[model samples]
Target: MAGCTGATSERTAAAVHGLPEDALLDMGDFAGAVLKYLRRHPVDRLTIAGGFAKLSKLAAGHLDLHSGRSQVDPRHLAALAREAGAGEDLAGAVAAAGTGLEALRLCAAGGVALGDRVAEAARATALGVLRGAPVTVDVLCVDRAGVVVGRAAPAGPPERGTAGGAARQD
Candidate 1:
């Protein structure tokens, strides 16, 4: 279900950027919201920034991050962990973790960049969702403390801090 936190973040971002409150949107559907907004607005660069759990879902190719529509699949994450060169034990732990954040923590402790992999996967997924919409999409996973735990920068004109690269700072 939608909550006040997302609305509050959107409003805060809009206010801080001096844009209209509606400029930054969160209707609980990430891909739907972007697609709907794109229908009326001309956007070149899009940044998908939010919690790690939903970002993990995005990495797993879920267009909708709502609890009703999708969930963070630990098995998919375990596969990503394996792709990141994590051992089977770690992958098993990730699959057993209660949340995406826990899986990330396990990867971090094991010197694996699971978040980076997840971010890149999420970026690719977002690009696929856009389907040649001429938008450069970046996926960033930030924790509650305002730390950029992971990021996937798309190839595009450099603006703000977006450069083509995978970021992992656990």
Candidate 2:
């Protein structure tokens, strides 16, 4: 089983190692804004997705001093990913608990955006977590005038914007 062990090590190395800082997932069809965002800022979603997986075990091993719990939970990782703006990969990685890193990587190939919908979807998929669900988290994209842009809130009813045709924040 030495070969098996070697293979496992190799896979782990890949996950922890080199991946484009600008690389984004290619999940079928991507939206225009996401594409635009990536084109404008070609970075690997802030590297939190990668850091979370790599540092989890190390963090867990020193639980007492760190006042830590049993291990790093998906939500914890999700928070890190969000702060890092790593997007869905953060959700998947934390949710998988080290198992679905590969799938997360694949999904992240399309790229990660700190958008309202993506964060909401990731939270729901990862752990049935939702925005403002005990964990106070809101994804707000605002312009120079401090005006909110992008998503307003899916479930909430639509409201009129200050200017006609302008996007509203719910």
* Candidate that would win on TM-score: 1
Candidate 1 per-residue C-alpha lDDT over 114-147 given as tens digits, one digit per residue, 9 for 90 to 100: 8888878877665555444556765556666545
Give the CA lDDT, 0 to 100, for residue 169 in model 1.
15
Off by over 4 Å in 1: 1-23, 36-42, 156-170
lDDT of 2 by residue, 84-168 (tens): 4565655656456543243234334535432332333322221121111222111222222332222213221112111111111
RMSD of each: 6.6, 18.2
At residue 55, give the lDDT of candidate 1. Answer: 75
What residue pairs are clashing in model 1? Answer: none
- The clash tally of candidate 1 reads 0
Each candidate's clash count: 0, 11
Could you say which candidate leads in lDDT?
Answer: 1
- TM-scores vs. true structure, each candidate: 0.74, 0.23
Give the poorly placed runs of model 2, Cα more than 4 Å off. Answer: 1-54, 59-72, 87-107, 110-170
